[model samples]
Target: MPQLDDGSESVEMSVAMLRRMAEQGVGAVCATSHYYRQQNSIETFCARRADALDRLLVNLPEGLPRILPAAEVAFFSGISEKPDLGRLCIQGTRTLMLEMPFSDWTDLQVEEVSALVLDRGFSVVLVHPERFCSSKGNRQKLRQLEELPVSLQVNAGTLLHWMDRRVGLNLLREAPIPLLGSDCHNLTTRPPNLKEGRKIVIQKLGSAFLDKMDENAADLTRQTANATT
Candidate 1:
C-alpha cells in the first residue's frame, strides 16, 4: 500500500484520502494504481493490487466514497490480447483506464486500442489526453481512437490550473470526453479537487454539462454499489 503511491506513508493514505473524498461528497472513487506491462505480469500486478486494497478496506474510513479497484495500465503492443486483462478492469465492470504512450503513436498502436473495444469488449477510458494534446498528428490519432467505443478523461487539476485551463477547456469542446477525475494522489499538493474543477466546468460549460458528466460516471460505476467480489 505504501509502495503504490510513493508518498502514501502506508494504508493510512487510503484512509485519509477517502475521508477527503467523503468530505467533498464524492460517491465513488476509482483506485487505479499504475500498471506497466514491461515491469510485471497482469496476474502479479492484480494480486498485489488486491492485497493493497484489502489492507485499505480493513480500516477504510466510514461513509467515504466507494472504492473501485482498477489499474491505469500503460499501453503496449498486443495488450488487447492479454488473457488476464479483464481482471484489471474496475471490479464488477468492464471499464479500463489507460495511459497512452508518451511517444507519437503509430497506426498499429491505434489499431490495437481499437481492438480493445471491438475485439476484446473492454470500455477503454483514455486518461488525461489534454496533457498530451499538441501536434495535429496526435490529435488526429485521438480522433481515430474516438471513432471507436472509447472515451477520454480529464483531470480536475488540469481545469483548475490557470495555465492549463485553456487547453483543458478546448479539449472539452473538441474531444469525446465523458469522464472527469480528481486524480488525487495525496492529502496536499495533488489532493482531490473534483469539486473545484466542477465549479470551473459549471462556469464555463454550465450545469447541464456537469450533470451529463455525473450521469456518465454513474453508468461507468453502476455495478460498484452491488458488487460483493
Candidate 2:
C-alpha cells in the first residue's frame, strides 16, 4: 500500500496496519514516501525517512508484511539533489516508484529518472499515470527511455476512477501486464484497496489472474525481506 502524506507522527498507524494485513496473508506493501514533506529540505526528508525506518522496525509485528521502504518519488529536473532518493533506493528497494507530475512532462524528465535509477543501481517502477500523458505511441517520449529497464505499474483502482476507467481496463488486458498495487492512502476516504482490487480482477479477468497476484505478492515481499537482511 502507498504511504500517506502525513508526517512522522502517522508512522505508527502505518506500521500497525501493515502488521494486521500481513497476519491476514497479505505479505507485501509498496510503501510510498510522499508523506515526509519532501518539498522541504533534503535533510528534513532524510530525517523523516529515518523516523519511518525506526518505527517500522520497532513496531512491526513478526509474520506480517515485510515492509519495503519505497517512494512515489516526484520526478523532476532537480530530483538529483534530493537526498531521499539515495536513502530509499539504497536502504530497502532496488526499485523506486516514481509519480508523474500533474502536467505533461517532457521526455527529458523521464530520461532523467531512468538515468538516476541506473546510476543508483536501482530499477524504476512508474506509478499511476496521468491519462494519455504517457501513452505507448509517444515515440519521442518513449525513445528517451529505450535503454532503461523499467516496470510500469498501473493502479487497479484506476479501473473504478471516473477519469481513467476505460484506459485502465484496456491496459489490464494487455500482455506482460504490470504489477497491481492497492495505492491505498487513508483509512476512510482512500483505504487500502488490495482486497477490493483482488475481487475486481477475479471478476473481470478471472480467478487465474487472482492466483497470480497472490503468488506474486508473496514472492515480492519475500525477496524484499531477504534483500533487507
Candidate 3:
C-alpha cells in the first residue's frame, strides 16, 4: 500500500511500484490507504481499496511482493468504542496502524487508545511517531503509550532525511520500535527506500537491531495467520 492516493487516481497501486519494492527487498507490503471518517464510510473505503487491489493484482507480473490488506486509519474521538472498528484493522490481524492527529492530543484522544488496547483487545501500532513526537509533551505521551500494549513504526524516509533522522534515531534508541515501513507514495516523490534505510540502521545500530525488528514483524504476521486459520 505504497501509493494509496498518488493524486492521479483514487488508489494508485501499480506493478511498477511492486517491482520497485521487490528490488528493495520488501517481501510483503500492507496496503494501508488513508482512511478518515470525513472522507467516506469504512464500507466504502474498503470497497474502493479492494477494487484498486484487484486492478493491481490482475495486471501484476510474477515474483512481486505480496500486498496485505490494511488501512492507515486517522484518529478520531470515540474511535475505539466503535464496534466495527475491528473491521478497519489489517486483514486477519488485530493490529491497527493509527495516524495520530497532528495537533495537540486531548485527554479523550489519549484515553481512546487505552480503551482500544486494554478494552477492545486490539494491537495498536502508532505510525511515524517522529512526525508528532517532536514536542516534549508529545514525546512523553508516546512514552506513556509504551507502557501499554502498543508498538511504534518508523518510516524509512524519516531515518534518511537529515532533519528527521535524529528524531528517528533517538526514538529507536530510547523506545521500543518494532516495525519500519517505507511509507512510499510513488517513484518520483516518496519512492521505496527501505534498502537505504536499512543500511543506515545497520550502520548506526548494527544488524542486530534490524534482526529484532524482523522478528517482531514475523511474530505479528504469524499471529494474524493463526487467528485466520
The clash count for each model shown is 0, 0, 1
The collision pairs in model 3 are 1-31
The best candidate in terms of lDDT: 1
Pick the TM-score winner.
1
Better of 1 and 2 by TM-score: 1
Model 2: CA > 4 A from native: 1-4, 7-12, 35-38, 41-43, 60-63, 78-84, 117-121, 130-148, 161-163, 173-177, 207-229
| Candidate 1 Cα outliers beyond 4 Å, as residue runs | 5-7, 224-229
Across 79-198, the per-residue lDDT of candidate 1 in tens digits comes to 877886877778888888899988888899998898888987787889999866776778889888887867778898999889999888776666565678887878888888998999
- The alpha-carbon RMSD values of the candidates against the true structure, listed in the order shown, are 2.6, 4.7, 2.4
**TM-scores, one per candidate:** 0.93, 0.70, 0.91
- Per-residue lDDT of candidate 2, residues 1-229 (tens digit): 2132652336566765675556445765656667333375546655666676776677666676756666667666666445445455424545566665666567677657766666655556666653434545443454455346554565767766757766665545542324567676655555566666666677777888767655544433343432321
By lDDT, the better pick of 1 and 2 is 1
How would you encode candidate 3's per-residue C-alpha lDDT over 127-181 as one tens digit per residue?
9888997677777778888888687888989998888888888777665556788
Whole-model lDDT values for every prediction = 0.80, 0.57, 0.78
Compute the lDDT of residue 158 as modeled in candidate 2: 76
After superposition, candidate 3 runs with Cα above 4 Å error = 1-13, 223-229
Task: State model 2's lDDT.
Answer: 0.57
Task: Please give the TM-score that candidate 1 achieves against the real structure.
Answer: 0.93
